[model samples]
Target: MSDPRHSVLLNTGSRMPLLGLGTGQLRGLENLMPAVDAALAAGYHQFDTAAVYRNEVELGQALRELLPKHGLERADIFITSKLAPRDQGPMAPAACQRSLDQLGLEYIDLFLVHEPGTEGLRVEDPQNSVNRAQSWTALEEFLSRGKFRAIGVSNYIVRHLEELFASCKVPPAVLQVEFHPRLAQTELRALCAQRSVCFEAYSPLGTGALLSDPVVLEVAKGCGRTAAQVLLRWAVQQGIPVIPKSSNPSRVRENAQLFDFELSQEDMDRLTGLDCGQRFDPEDPSLVA
Candidate 1:
């Protein structure tokens, strides 16, 4: 990894940067390369993308060129990609391989199901119904073959996890979710802790709300840090690995400069109190129908 100081060693014994660069919103071939290049230049070694993002080929090009030019190799970075909703079921493995081809990587550090059995677009159910159990079975085969170093699911609820536990043979190593001060996800956090699933929080800045919060701004002023820095620190202190997306060069560096400060118990409690179940990307159960 380029930035050793900002790394968070995961339970799988892999050292991933606590602050990952998210490319979910990054679009267009032109926008993708420069953003990725900016992130890499800022010393970010973890990149999060998905097949559905449709920028994998461009991202792959950026990585393949940028790393070698900077004297960095593939292993020097941790890359995560996901299997899309349509690519589930018996075709999941081949679909994963396709993603690998697009990423131009031999092994992915983490592979996740983009969403749960929503819309009946699972591998096991052809009737367009949510059949997570069947999809998970396909995930198991990928895990068993070491195609992915670690495997998990994204956007899963408590019920989804419960269902997974009831059916899966191997427990998930990580669970990626939309987490921030606004959407603290207390219940899911506690459940993951109980189950030994490392929770990785995406959009830890509340999709920019926390960055503009009055309370966060106040704290940032007092602490001599940006609101984004304060928010990132809050999540890191909670031991939740966070990936904050940014294409701006300065902002990318600012996001990674969060390890120096530690939030106090009082500060943590104060931040925790900001939670009101304000999920930026709240899942609708009816979508599963």
Candidate 2:
């Protein structure tokens, strides 16, 4: 517990950084490059991306160009990307190759199936359990080929994982999901721990919606930290990884400032009690235009 920069151990025994940067929702070289520059300067060593983000090329270029300036190398950083849903079944490995070409990396540190099911590519047609098993087969094939060090899934629930584990040869090493004080995901957390799968929290700040929460703010004030830091600290303290996205340099720097302090047990309980199963997704009115 003393090491604030501790890495979460995956089933593969590879160390995944507990705190990372999310590159979704911020496309184009203009934003991705500078935000990454700021994140690098802020001491971030991990980055999350996806094929759907449409910034793999730009992100790869930016990191390649910027790393030299900071005297860093690929080994110093951990990169995570995802396979899109449309590329389920036989298309999964091809998509990973395309992503490798886009990122220009020798091998990805971690790669995940972005979604459990596909739209229409498979005969099963958006079949959750079967598609996941099929896509996992592709991932496992490429994984042995040295395309990705560890493979996992995003947006997958308990049942999908159980089914995948039953029929697949490789077990998922990580699970990424939308998490915050509002959506505690306690059962998912328990299941992940039980299976030794490292849980990674996306939108840990609630995509800017949880920063102003009264409960979060109250806990932050007592800890003398910002709401974002409190939330990130809470997630990592629970032995989960968190990726918080921000383009503002100051805010980007501020987002990873969770290592300085520890949240009290009482404050953790208060934050835990704040969970009422609230979630923010694309369907949320506040997110729509």
Query: Best by TM-score, which number?
Result: 2
How far residue 271's Cα lies from its native spot in candidate 2, in Å, is: 0.5
Candidate 2 regions exceeding 4 Å error are 1-5, 120-126, 283-289
The Cα error of candidate 1 at residue 245, in Å, is 1.0
Q: What is the C-alpha RMSD of each candidate to the true structure, in Å?
A: 2.8, 3.8
Candidate 1, backbone clash total: 5
- The lDDT of model 1 is 0.78
lDDT of each: 0.78, 0.84
In the range 22-51, model 1's lDDT, one tens digit per residue, is 998787767777777777776778899998
